[model samples]
Target chain A: MEGLIDGVLPDAAELPGLVADLRTARSGISFVYDVIEKLAERYELSDAVMVLDHPELGRQAFRSARRPIGEASAMHLNVLECPEGVHGVPGGVDPVSASVAVELCRIALDLDLYRHDSRHDGLTGLYNRRFFDVMFRRCASQSARYGWSFSVVIFDIDSFKQLNDRFGHMLGDRVLQVVGAEMHHALRSSDVAGRVGGDEFAILLMRADRENVPAFMSRIRAAVEANMEMSVGFSFGIAEAPVESTDPAELYRLADARLMAAKGTKR
Target chain B: MSVPASSEEVRLAPLGDSGDEDESPPFDALELEIRRLPGVVAVGWHRGEAMRACLSVGGFGLSALRSRAVQLARGHLDEPLSVELSDVEGVFAASSVASVRIIDILVAGGEVEVRLGAGHLIGTGRAGTGPEGAALATIRALDDLGIGASIELRIASAVVLPSDLGLAVVVSVVDRHDGSEHRSIAYASSVEESAAKAVIEAYELIGEQSRDQAQSAIR
Candidate 1:
């Protein structure tokens, strides 16, 4: 694909530098930004946004080049081999830019899948323990920087071991997958939930404080219960990051302790 | 703004024919047939989920209309848009814009169906003057396996430096049938060169997958 503009699109003399600029972007979001910014300079369009489906995050979009007017007739962001939606700017992407965009969007999608795999559990496809660690630390750091607290809830399925022993491992696995799916469906996209250990899950509710943790947890627990339907139950303990403790480890420890206490109280 | 306008009557389904493979309707032919619809300019194939129509962008570009299209697609269709929009756009851009109607595609139970819009159209100002053809054709095409399928593609990281000397691109491609993935990271003196090298490497990996599939079929 050397001299992509020249070799592929002979007529598009104006697209080489723009494609190169798009190539300079290190990630999908930045790629969208680069496309917008460079396109504005090259094509005289103002503003641009690229929206695509992300595996774990669902839908994600980025803005950079800025916009023409709202009346600028809509054009397909057909720069790549993706089914991505576009916003901002008008007229249309030059053919060569469209080619480059197609490849870039395809790459962006691959990255989303890669990130999802690296972070998710194999069996249940939920965020894994390692992802939990990373996200927890990020939440704590954000709390420190933003002066707001996010809540961490660590919970375990009641009698998961008993279920495994009685129903065998396959049923146990199904239970885990079901619970994970339920949790994913019940939680917001920004809220990250992970399978931390056998039968244990952790959720980080962004911008949530201790005061609202109960309502979120209660609503989720009920929903999960109804979804699971075989008399399944989960017990969780919530703690505010940076509010209850500044350290992510410390916050997790506190949440774990409270989880144990909650389990005891139930018993 | 040519959102599929829903008509009073929807011929929902070649229903209750779950097990009748002999009842295989022309649904298998819908892939190519969909493109010939009154307004469908292009086609995108994807794994999982029903076909969702993103509203037409007309002659302009997608930057303005994408969000509203996504929002409407989600509300109108039960499944989210899994097919890549860029590809669809590319297909249309590569073709003639003679027809005006833009129709979204759907597949199920060995059948392909296109729904007319549910009243409102999405996008900024007025787009093409052509009418929607959701009513034109019901049959959409399927892949060779009589299923909708899309290959996995991804861009890892592609970066070009301000100095104009160092450039790098990392790409990954996975086979949708199998979970195997190929990753490549290349560094070069130019961004285009790096991207080309990365694509080559990923393509090499995908080639291996093709060979494997062929061998498995032979066995």
Candidate 2:
């Protein structure tokens, strides 16, 4: 991958724009299209395609060429993040074609890594609201594909603002970290947990449709309560997704509603 | 070898050309230039889609270059991989907890295909023209002082049926290619037995490919 970037950046100062383009891309497909279009301009190529091994979509390609995707010899573009097939660009101009191909790949990966960082809470190192939104959609897709049920659990540190006011933000932060850590440890590999708010955490459990979600939530709650200060408690809510609605927004709304109802019980 | 063995510079184009629709330097050119670099004894890229040029700066070079060599080879890839360069020598998917052990950077076609454990492959010419050559070349691709001829085995999944009536194992071989390829599709009554059967089947398939290569050569 370094061979694609070494020293070439000095002459190809415009390469930064390629990376910048990655930031602007809203989705993976757009990231790929942005690369292909830019490389076509730089390498004087006619067409290209992005073959990606998306976790949900599996091995798939987004082609720009009017003709067949072409053979291996026609492959020009390559990227680091592409796990499966070659990220190739066909009919490219010499030297520039290879360099741009490699740069685009690196840039795309950088964009992804950067994007991932942005979706995580710096303190707890858990997924943030941004990732939650994305993963929720993914869960929808997964559930539909496998007919497996998923659930969303949302909870808040009861009277968290009070904890911050009394214990100083440092201790409050420490408690939040502890809660996040416990949730992380308690989670199954198929689960996604995010610190969506300061003291509020959300989890999406894949394959929990048939299982006792409340029981699972209670386990996590117990783990957190065991580690948390006596004054700090939690309220919880869970909604089964891929059941009534494939949309995560709907699930979020339902979960929030249930969360409020659960808090009412505490009151 | 005319290209200097000591300094192998794989130059890429894409000079932010405003008007040039050119892609970049050809893999063949990069391969040729890479061959010129010092200590680089052999070069092979399968089918051009799978790889590019890799360089291990200062010391580690062969593994770095193998990714780039994959740009020319042609084959089916199964699952993505990240190498654990540490003592664990575990092969995990990029998304998992493990980070890929990448000592150097090379223009790889896809993921890093050369598992340094594959044995005695460093500085050898490309393999996969047939079967035995492919397996041997695979070993040579990651040849180090004491490491060679080792395959990185990863199990994608293992499931025990109700009451252990049957067991299933998906044995993932992370040797040179990434992604899923079923060398042997079989079922067994025991998890241990099933996994063993899968490995044996993969070995048999590789052996057959090698023999076919030999037979074709003799013809």
Candidate 3:
């Protein structure tokens, strides 16, 4: 009764199922659209606008109605921000169920955001160490079973400490971001990249031989050099699966050892 | 599979030292830290042996809090941990959360007895003298209100704040029944009052959680 007026709210009896459906939605976009679709069907809402500010996906709105925009009555434009407990719908409109749906959608979005954040690096938008390790093991097992070959590339920014000391962490982080963006852009969809350490990054190149990895790294290196404001440089090492070693740990070590050697040669 | 190792500069201590042989895992420390993260409300673990958790979250940094919780759990738990975080934005809002407050404190015969009240409900607890006793007494009083379970005191101390801030009491408590931990600090003229307030502050969320659970069950 607190949120109910003359507008349509989801029937009280159907809320549990609706909430369950929203909870199980695979992603935030699906969740928001599902709510809009449900509202349109249940309440026959002629016009509705649901805006979401997602952490990863940015700002998006899911709107559903039988007519064009700007025609919705003031009653239909009521916004529900659950965290602040503010309801903006005008009097004589029943938005109780819609408000609940919006709140549930927000919750689902938060869950999705956290789930994503948990697996990826905050600064670089690359896989975090935990998830990268997970993918590495999965790839290693599958490659061994199928007798396929893959490559692990381990690299770090050259003189990264000196760069951070001279430029401060802000610029240093920008360099990492640029490097990460380049890696993301240059890598094949099947490949996996992660920010493994402060300045260190690891890439699992699916179906790639050690010999072929240099070509991919070259592209990434060129992109980084072209995009970066400062003259940033990096060194890398690569190891192949089955040929070098199928063991995940051993492959990492092999790649890391080569990375250290490259750094030494650069010095 | 092993977690990818970070540089030594950013590496955390190993998780093997989470708890002692005779005690349970250090969920209290983990919970206290997780709660301090942005957008976290009440957090609790499942009742069984599994290292699963439920967190009530709101505001920004949901991902940071979720990721950090896993990282922190890895540091405190030996087993692989899974966290289930939900957005129960208004569930733990201050509007409904309630806890008993210290109405009176009496020390006699090297023991401390504290009286706490919320509305018409009055609860009393007694323990040996000192900050530890005061904290325990506060927990006992919460139990007497039918709002708390057996609590293990992880830390109870009085410390002087920096920059002439003044004296403060910090109390960390773990609920044995549910395996949730809470920590809070309070500044008071006397150590006894400070400890009591800190414990009371810590239990407010737990109290709200239990009340919500009971209400849900009733509904």
Candidate 4:
């Protein structure tokens, strides 16, 4: 493949094709993998690594290698503002085309980020109601098909309107943000949490029933207490599928009814 | 699905549709479509509560954007979605005016001094402290520039939006010759600065309205 790079700037001819590939990339990791594959094929490099700075994901390194190695080569191709450069690039590569390729990679990452932002709540960083419902249905379908069990929890901040009226909405928003962060930290990757309403939250726990929920709630409470300056309290209701009901809407209603009962006892 | 077509009806709409296989999310497409409507500057869910769209001054496509926003939000939200349409013409228009600039503002003891600059031209005014005083100083500075006679500016209110949304100052200026009130809301990090800009934008709005009225009369 050394003959492919024999020209003064052979990579310049590859720019358009690289851009088209970047355009069709589904995610940043896949795009980096494709770039590494292309570099390996075009330049006969055994390995490649790309270090990227993303607004949301921060700094991350993606690596591709033909075989397990003790150490990667030290060569770097400077791309965009990535002064650290893309490591493992061969010496003969064109700087101009390499920079353009990296820039296209950056734009592709941004497009994915926008796609993510749309599905999440801006203030709390949880799945918004719309996306949450979609995910919930998928989980429910899987459970029904395979006879797996899961639990649904619905809860809201107690006397939240009073809290907003007394302390103002800024403090109220702060409480919500802190609670959201706590919920995000408390749940496992398989579990999903969403901001279903103002000061309201819902969680879907996979492979778990109501019996396994208190520990998760305790973790959220502990985190909230550790992070927040003010005392913020909430009530929750949990119902398990197959044990409670198979219907998704019925599960939510059961959880909500229990939530109302819990709130009633608190008062 | 068919959305409620009532142009004034505002309801809670959900976020994005994840079913889309497109590169960009549906929320972004909705936002882009709304922004493309005449006079819209920004569109988003207001802190995950309501859909809020900010419109530019003299913008004409409110009804169109409102309906589209409702349609876009239909399946994404389950609650009563309130669509908030705020006129941001005053704050945004001041930035895009090209000529005018608020050079300096000094509040000392019981008085305030304001300096207005447009290219090489400068105007100065002094008044008492507070938003009303800020508006007074701005009008005086405009008078110094030989442009204040067309309207009489007054400070209406300087208030903060909930959840630290920022401070906004409302200025109601009367077209002295025509006896019509032109109310403008300008937002800034500080109340005094918002008041100063609100007064200036109200003046600009009055000038545009008068020109429009004159053209209409001629036609």
Number of the top-ranking candidate, with DockQ as the measure: 1
Interface RMSD of each: 18.5, 19.4, 20.7, 21.7
What TM-score, to 2 decimal places, does chain A of model 2 have?
0.57
Candidate 3, after superposition: displacement of residue B112 in Å?
47
Candidate 4: residue B46 Cα off by (Å)? 41
lDDT of 3: 0.61
lDDT of 3 by residue, B33-142 (tens): 35434444444444335556666555334665566677655534455667777664442322222335576787876978787764223467878777889998887877
- Stretch of 10 with least lDDT, candidate 2 chain A: A63-72
Summarize candidate 4's per-residue lDDT along A1-267 as a digit string, tens digits.
Answer: 123222423454556576556546555434654675566556565455554443333233344431111122344432211332355545433566556556555665566556656776765667899888887887777778888888889988888999977864545666776677666545654577899999889998888757767776676666666766556567899988767777888889999999999999998
lDDT of 2 by residue, B1-219 (tens): 011111222122221232112211233223222322222322222223322222211122435434423321111112121211111111111111111111221122221222221111112222322223333333333343122223444443455567846656555454343333444434554333354445445543543343355445444
Chain B TM per candidate, please?
0.26, 0.27, 0.48, 0.52
Q: Write the per-residue lDDT of candidate 3 for residues A1-267, one digit (tens) a residue.
A: 123311233453435576557545444434554566556555444445554433322222333421111222443432222222212222221456655666666666555556655776765667899989988988899888997878899988888899877864445766786777677556654577899999999998877767776676677667767766466677899988878788999999999999999889977
Comparing 2 with 3 on TM-score, the higher-scoring candidate is 3
lDDT tens per residue, model 1, A1-267: 336434654544445554454344333333444555555556555545444433222223333321211212444542322235444355445555655554555454355335445766755556789977987777788788887668888988888999877864545665776666566555654577889999999988877666766675566567556755666767888888666786898888988999999899888
Candidate 3 TM-score, C-alpha based: 0.47
Q: Compute the lDDT of residue A170 as modeled in candidate 1.
A: 42
- TM-score of each candidate? 0.43, 0.36, 0.47, 0.50
List model 1 lDDT by residue over B138-207, tens digit each: 1111111111122344444665656855657666655465667777777754443344345445544554
Superior candidate under TM-score, 1 versus 2: 1
Per residue, candidate 4 scores C-alpha lDDT tens digits across B1-219 of 111213332221222234244323434443433333333433334333444433232233345445545543442333334455654433222222223468778776687777775422346777887788888888887766432245676445877778967778898988777789888888876777788899888876765565455445444
Interface RMSD of 1: 18.5
Residue A182 C-alpha lDDT in model 1: 61
Clashes (backbone N, CA, C under 3 Å), per candidate, total 40, 68, 3, 6
